[model samples]
Target: MKYYSTNAKAPLATLHEAVVKGLASDSGLYMPEYLYKLSADFFDSIQNLPFNEIAKIVATAFFGEDVEQKALDEIVDDTLQFDCPVVEVSDNIYSLELFHGPTLAFKDVGGRFMARLLQYFIRKEGKEEVNVLVATSGDTGSAVANGFLGVDGIHVYVLYPKGKVSKIQESQFTTLGKNITAIEVNGVFDDCQALVKKAFMDEELNRHMKLTSANSINVARFLPQSFYYFNAYARMKAAGKADNLVVCVPSGNFGNITAGLFGREMGLPIKRFIAANNANDVFFKYLQTGKYTPMASIQTIANAMDVGNPSNFARVYDMFDGDLQKIRSVVSGATYSDEQIRETMKSCFDSNGYILDPHGACGYRALEEGLTDGETGVFLETAHPAKFKETVESAIGAEVEIPERLAAFMRGEKKSVEMSADFDSFKNFLMTR
Candidate 1:
């Protein structure tokens, strides 16, 4: 149950240290020392259990050594109140609808799970305060903000790129006035992420406040994402289509897909995976060439996948011992342009009466092109279509009715401080205010 830094420079840490610290002192992501594979009987009975029931077993397998059975049960129950159902989108391709939670995105599982787990740690240790810093290109801000809202002894600061996120995405976090503060960063997501990483490493900031990240870089945040993949497999199994199963995830910070890979390693019976990318295709290019080179990100309709230098890539590299052929055997890549995303969204709507948000469109298109015969592909519909109302409407030539939750959020008054993406400015703001 011990976690080690992917960089292999920091001391080995307990699950508590890894979750609370968020990032290593050496600026590396923390990963579990060893992954525990599930038993065959577990998978045999998984298809018959409820979503939360399946989650409890899987969560226990990963976190049981670190957390007590009763406490872990409560955490899994609190986190998985919502369901993720796999809906057939094409003949052999399905879309795992992961947007049924409060924030209507896949990250809700991680955000809520992390919030509960962190609060458990806080209450047990009598910590005065813990501040969560999260960077988002889109859905993560809302998911984290809503997840941590009003939690005792915790404050959340959501840093999102100005004008890059959808209005609904921005509103969901910025309007939450208590315990959650949204900062409109005058730069891209990479800048916001850099600021968080720097703040975690800065001695002055650490002295002033307990700093941890809710970004995928945090094991507490991303490891719970494995719950989503397991739930998807369970659902597929119930439908009697578990054989030759392939999961496709829309990759941004690479947390979602990496969690899926973890599930595969844990004997999830998944045949392979597809990391669908938008215009910011650094990971895709790396999968193609076996050389990872980070660059500045470009804006795309699938804004959530717009990360240039994914922090979780380090964990992915470490998980497979930096073996390219090993990664390629179970995982593949596909990149799409904004035009292609629009086209796929339109086509899905026209052909099947199914609406896809831009991010899911990339996943759907990738699965459509990549799935071979006798394989059933399940692409993650990571967010609700209504989240990107305007863009989706334009693409499908039909109106997207805003969900009640999103509509309420949009009506709330915005209340975030505008700040430059500079580390000094961010640090000073935190120290001064």
Candidate 2:
């Protein structure tokens, strides 16, 4: 399979080049020149195959002969070391638990897969060194940091909003010292994202450093996310309850929802998608008005979705050929305030004994608001509730137990440098590093 930039300027590239370049020279996300749809028989066959087998089939289809079968198998083994459990939260609502991985967040699938793929690519091309630049609001930094930690020939630099992320989220990135460096920006997530994008576009920087990205903008980051969507369908089929299903995703950068749409295009039996958002509701407004107007993002308890201008929305738009009607037909979007998120968390716990973090609660609220309309809606619980312990405990009047992974985080020492959001400051930091 060959990949081309959606901007139509860059030449078609192999999967290795697409993974390494991240964004195209024309500043577009890379997409396959052609998408190969999976047959219905293949979807039916997934129920019998192990998760790793299913991943290999999907990976080989997109990556072709670039990644060896043995290397691809190792990639799947390392990436999917957790379960994506679909727990019934009520009569009509279900919560897909996606926090069982090492970093206890859904980004683990994409981050880990990207790291392994990069390692394989570097080995094949005989590159001596590579640098991965990423920006995150919460879970992404830790997932990327942990995924690429101590990997030979690669270094990861993560930038996050200072004092905005949860304590645990901050610790996850800052605690890892070797080959992973964390920088705290004094602005919002958009500011951090802008710095990373600018670095990729800098010609001088590219000459001296091979700059890659682990953010959702990378095709590598988007591809592995399609696995869990198929996994969810497989689980439902095993229970003999397979039907038209709608997935409620707490979308910030819009990567997860875009991947789900990709799965639907690949023959997954999905009815629709709900793009749940916090106060920074640019996506919600775009779904309603067909015009994307970005503004300053507001800080909410669901800090991850606090992106005013999501980079992956460009991919979503490209998927629909800039046709608003078609986009609306396949995807629905809604926004919730901090108060609504808290209320939904309390109600879900009281009524169904499910503890949801603030981000997932936004998804539950979106489902409750009738956006899904009685469909078998599965709201994605993207992070462990312990990630937002204070909010969950105060709203539910109880404590959320920390997992062993997070308990270990408490003992790790945090190491990070604070910097202004100016581009010159970021450039200076990169030069010194």
Which prediction has the highest TM-score against the true structure? 1
Distance from true position, residue 381, model 1, in Å?
0.2
The top-ranked prediction according to lDDT is: 1
> TM-score of model 1 relative to the true fold?
0.99
Task: Please count the clashing residue pairs in each candidate, in the order shown.
Answer: 0, 0
In angstroms, how far off is 13's CA in candidate 1?
0.7
| 12-66: candidate 2 lDDT, tens digit per residue | 8888888998888888889877667887788877777767677777777667667
Error of 2 at 22 (Å): 1.3
> Please, what are the lDDT tens digits per residue for candidate 1 over residues 296-364?
999988888889999888988988899999888878999999999999999999999999999999999
Deviation (Å) of 398 in candidate 1: 0.9
Model 1 worst lDDT window (10 residues) = 53-62
Clashes of 1: 0
Worst lDDT run of 10 residues, candidate 2, spans: 368-377
